[model samples]
Target: MNRILRVKEISELLGLSKSTIWRMRRDGLFPAPLKIGPRAVGWRESDVTDWIKSRDRLQ
Candidate 1:
């Protein structure tokens, strides 16, 4: 099963600020969050992992 990650978790995992993550999403450089609730959003673990791998390749 795929795990859902919260903004704090994602921020720590990527070593980026929440604002940066939001900016990346706006720029289409990051994975979009899943709407988990009326006022909540989360990212799929697999999607984040894949994104990290792809970024690693670009370096």
Candidate 2:
């Protein structure tokens, strides 16, 4: 199963602030997070990795 990364982890991985990540998500510039629980959400590891790869390609 794919790992689900919470906001903190994603922020660290992307070297971005949590708010920045949220803004990117809201602006449709980042991958949408999955609803993992009643009040929690996370992004799929694969999805995040793919987003990184796509960014690399764009550079």
Candidate 3:
């Protein structure tokens, strides 16, 4: 099963602020988060990992 990552965890993993992540999502530059709860959102682990790999390729 795929794990869901919260904003704090994603921030730590990507070395980016939570606000930046939100902004990226807003601009469609990052994967859209999944609605885990009525008021909570998270990204899938595989999605994040793939995004990291794509970035690595660009560097």
Q: Summing lDDT over every window of 10 consecutive residues in candidate 3, give the lowest-scoring window.
A: 28-37
User: C-alpha displacement of 30 in model 3, angstroms?
Assistant: 0.6
TM-score of each: 0.96, 0.97, 0.95
Candidate with better TM-score, 2 vs 3 = 2
lDDT of 2 by residue, 1-59 (tens): 99999999998998999999999999999999999899999999999999999999999
Write out the backbone clash pairs for model 1. none
lDDT of 2 at 36: 89
Best by TM-score: 2
Which of the two, 1 or 2, has more TM-score? Answer: 2
lDDT by residue (tens digit), candidate 1, 1-59: 99999989999988999999999999999999999999999999999999999999999
Say what the RMSD of model 2 is: 0.5
Give, for candidate 2, the lowest lDDT window spanning 10 residues.
6-15
Q: How far out, in Å, is residue 14 in model 2?
A: 0.9
List clash counts for every candidate, in order: 0, 0, 0
**TM-score of model number 2:** 0.97
Task: List ranges where model 2 is wrong by over 4 Å.
Answer: none
Residue 47, model 1, lDDT: 97
